[model samples]
Every structure is written in structure tokens, then in C-alpha cells.
Target: METAVKTTWKIDTAHSEIAFKVKHMMISTVTGYFEDYNAEVNTTKEDFSDAEFSFTAQTASINTKNADRDAHLKSDDFFNTKTYPEMKFTSTSFDGTTLVGDLTIRDVTKKISLEVDFNGVVVDPYGQTKAGFEISGELNRKDFNLTWSAVTEAGKIVVSDKVKLQLNLQFIKS
Candidate 1:
């Protein structure tokens, strides 16, 4: 039997981003990001099959441009950062494409899958090996207990249950 030794990679935060978009009032989209996050990637070969991925984002680092709105998201009605200070994901499988993992938010954990596109690997001028990926998925906020919502007099929903997540990640071999 052939055995493959996995290589570990560290996330290059300066070159990576974790962002999301949610519909507001069933109209425009509100974009946001987690200012602080980290991830680990382990792979047997460049193809990235039999890979392991894990990530965590500081709940308090959530930013939505509007300070008030950001604060509200961190409150008890939403993430309740004080109680659940971090969101996390651990991959169960990756076939060089789809990624299946367990996502935890506000102490609630659920199995979720994200579509992934590998952008190839490169060697930087500094001789650092790096890899890139664009990943996206949609999840219901309510599933993670982010049940806060409001309704206008016109009967419009203030916040939609579904949230769209986008991640542009770059990792450096460690």
C-alpha cells in the first residue's frame, strides 16, 4: 500500500478574507466581513484530495460597515459574542471541489457544504509556496440561533434568514 504524508499549511491572513452578504428588507444586499480569522489546511498532494481544513473566526470581529448594526449583530438577539466568542468549521471531506464540514455559530453546530474552486498554487518571489481558493455557500442564520429579526409597518422583513458566505483564502506552506 502507498502511504502519503500530508503537508500542513498556514493561512496567510493578510491575503485572505472571509466575507458575507445578506439581503436587507428583501431588497438590497448588505455585505460584511470577519476582521479576524484563521485556518489550517492539510493536503497529501497538490490536487488537494484527502485534505483536511479547519477555520475559526472571532465573533467580536464581525463588521458590517455600520457600527450600530455591527453592535446589534454581536448582541444577545444575534451572535451573543460574549457567550459564543467564536465561529468554527471543520472539514470532513474535499474532493478538489466541494467541501463538507461542520459549522458552529452561537454554540449551535450544523453540517454544511461549501462549493470550492482551487485557483492553483504558486511560488512567491520570497520562495514561499502559496495556494488560493474561492469558496461560497448559503446557510440559514436561524439554524445557528441568529434568530433576531424585525418587521416594518409595511410588513417587510428586516432581515432574511438566509446568509450568503464568500471566502477568498490564501495559504502558505508551513
Candidate 2:
């Protein structure tokens, strides 16, 4: 009988971040993050092609350095954290550096693909094995039911409908 080996990884939050950017005022881009999230990866060796991954983010933890703006985002006009407090992702397939998964947000589930670059693995000075990844993907907010906008007096939508996501994750083998 052949025994299968799997490696598990726990996200290092202090060294990981999830962020997004969107066009604002049709002139500049606004960026922000959830500030709190958790992720895990299970794989054979270091090949993501054989990996299973999942991540969860607290919707109410969004932070843009502005309390008022953050509060507004958590209101019913946006994430409506009281109703849907968590956003989640689970991978369904991995092809080389690309990951296909289902992302759930605001009670809507959408299939999304991410282009990932495995930054290879390293052995830290503390004698721990770790891996680093820089992954990015974009999804239309409308598809996830995040549609909320206002037309400005200048005729521009107060908010853009498209949101771009970027994730930087560092994981320690467990």
C-alpha cells in the first residue's frame, strides 16, 4: 500500500495581508483591507497543484484608516456585516499557478479564479519551514451582490462597481 503524505500550513497573519482597490470619484483609486482573516492550506509536498485551501475574513473588520468611512461600509449599503459577517473562499482546482475557487460574500457565492505565484519555501532561523505566495485576482462586485452606488452631482457614480483584490500570504508548515 502506498501511503500519502500531506503538509498543512497555518497562515501567519502578522506577515499576511488581504487588500483591495477600486476607482473612486472616477478619478483616483481607494484601497482598504479587512485587517482580520484566517487561512489554511493542505498539500502534498510544496506543489499547490495538489493543494486544498480555504480562507475566511471578517467583514466588519474592514479598515481604511477612517472610522466613519469604515462604519458606512459595514452598513446595509455595503457589506451589511450584521447579516453576513464573514466572507469565505475555498479552492476547487489548482492548475500550475492558477487557482479556481468559490468565493462567498454577502450571501452570494461566485466562482473566481486567481493567478498565483508560489514564491517557494524557506526554512526560517527558528528552524521552521514556511512558504510565501503572492496571489492576485479580480471579481465584479455586482456578481457578489455588493451593488450599492450613488450618482454624484458631477454625474459620476459615487462608487465604482468593480473591486480588485490582492493577497500576500506567508504560511508556516505545521
Candidate 3:
């Protein structure tokens, strides 16, 4: 009997991004990114049909191009970096198109499905084998204990509950 060695692919943070968008005041969109994050996947198949992925991002690393907004996100009103400094996700299944996983934020975990687009693999000019993927998903902020809310004096919402997540990932086989 022969044992197959699973190939481990680690995210190249320099070429990857973890970003999200949420409606602000029911009028405009606010975009944010986690400056520190990492992901890894192990697979035995060439097409990655059997790959299992796990990822995490530091809550304190949230950046929205605005210091005040970033600080607010790290406060108790949102991620609460002082208490839960990280968010995580682990894949349960992947079927080439849809990926079902458990996402944890602020100690609250929930199952979520994400659309995956495999951008194929290639050897970079630096002689490194790399794979790319564009993944998207959405979640309700309140579902993860990020339940802070506010209403304008005009009876409008200060923030929408829905948050759209986008991840552009690049991995190097390690």
C-alpha cells in the first residue's frame, strides 16, 4: 500500500487581499480590509477538488482608510479587538463552484456558503508555482455578534446589517 502526500499551499500575503463592503447610513458603501491575514490549503488532487482550507485575520488590523472608522471597528461596537482579536474560517466542503464553511467572528460561529472562482495555476517569473482564486460571500453583521446599531434623526439607518466579503487569494505551493 502506498500513502499519498497531500500538498500544502500557503497564502502569499503580499499578493492577496481580504476585503469587505458594507452600506453606511443606508446611503453609501464603506470598504474595509484586514491588513494581517493568512490562509492555507491542503490537497491531494491536481484540480484541488479535495482541498481543505483554513484562514484567519487579525481584528485589530482592520483598515478603512479612515482612522476613526477603523478604531470604531476594533471597539466593542464591532469586532472588539480587545476581546476577540481574530476571526477565522474553515472549509467544510468545496464542489468546484460553491464552498461551504464555518466562519467565526467575535466567538460566534456560523455556516456560510461562498462562491469560488478558480483562476488556475501558473509558474510565476520568479520560478514559483502559484495559484489564484477570487472568492465572494455575504453575511449579516449581527449574526457574528457585531450587533451595534444606530438610527439617524431622520429615521434612516446608520448602518446596514449586510456585509459583503471579497477575497483575492494567491497561494504558493509549500
Candidate 4:
């Protein structure tokens, strides 16, 4: 497709999720989701190739379904929510199937690549045009300065550095 006029898209947060999982104690995986987040995309193609994407998730919004653990995660050892307060991503390139972006957390930024499965665009019952995407990736938490460490009494690691990301996103054309 030729470069057309760029269209703006807003995230449909009510139907989307920004989630990640990391091994806990080297035996179990703990899943967490950001309860508050937003994303914007501007693109000239309906397929979203070469789009300019920006995303942000509140660091304090991290939820793992556990209160104490959640609070701990917000402390200095991890996100230090009060200090950094937000996680952000800005896309550098998109090729329909892959996305390369600079992901920032705790004020640290790193270029990361993610696999994107464009689920195509559709009009909803409300006559709104929406696009769906499944994006997945992995990164070392330590890479972003989230270097809190711990150990189990039995000599097991508390939190694994490797985090797996799975984001299901829906965006509406505006």
C-alpha cells in the first residue's frame, strides 16, 4: 500500500490487556497485569505496518492478585512506583509481523523486539472500526534496573530475571 494520510487510533482499554509473567522460586510462574494503561498509534496503512506507536502503563497499577506482593513490587526493590511511576514504550519500526521499540522502566530504556500477530480490522456493533493484535516477547527484568534479588530458605531463587510478555490489544480508529 502507498503511504496515505495517517490515521490515529486509540486503545480500547476495556477489552485489552497488558500482562507479563515471571518465574517465582524457579518453580512457579506468577502472572501480573497492569490495571491502568494506554496506547496510541498513527499509521497510513490499515495493516499497521510502519506505524508510530506509543504506550504507557502506570507502574503503581501493577497487580498480581496479591496485596502484599503487589506492594512489594511497587517498592524500591522493583518498580519504585513513586519514583519512576510509569513504564513506557515507543515503537521504532513495525513490519506487520514484528515490532521493534524502546521499552522504558524505572527510567531505564532498552531496544526490544516483539512478535506481532495482526488480527485484522473490523467494525463493531457500534459502527466503530477496531484493530486487534496479539504481541509477545521476553526480556530480562535486570536489563531495566529492576534488580531486586531474593532467595528461598531452601536455596531457590525468589524471582527470575526473565519475564515473558503477552499483550492483547484492541485499538479503535478515530
Which candidate wins on TM-score? 1
Model 4, 77-131: lDDT tens per residue? Answer: 9999999999999999999899999999998999999999999999999999999
Q: How close is every model to the real structure, measured as TM-score?
A: 0.98, 0.96, 0.97, 0.97
Any idea how many clashes model 3 has? 0
Q: Summing lDDT over every window of 10 consecutive residues in candidate 1, give the lowest-scoring window.
A: 42-51
Report, for every candidate in turn, its global Cα lDDT versus the true structure: 0.95, 0.90, 0.93, 0.95
RMSD of each: 0.9, 1.0, 1.0, 1.5
Candidate 1 lDDT over residue span 1-174, tens digit each: 999888999999999999999999998999999999999999998788778999999999999999999999999999899999999999998998999999999879999999999998999999999999999999999999999889999999999999999999999999
Location of the lowest summed lDDT over 10 successive residues in candidate 4: 44-53
lDDT of 4 at 29: 98
Q: Model 3 scores what on Cα lDDT?
A: 0.93
- In model 1, residue pairs whose N, Cα or C atoms come closer than 3 Å (at least 3 residues apart or on different chains), thus clashing, are none
In candidate 3, stretches whose alpha carbon ends up further than 4 angstroms from where it belongs are: none
| Candidate 1 stretches greater than 4 Å from native | none
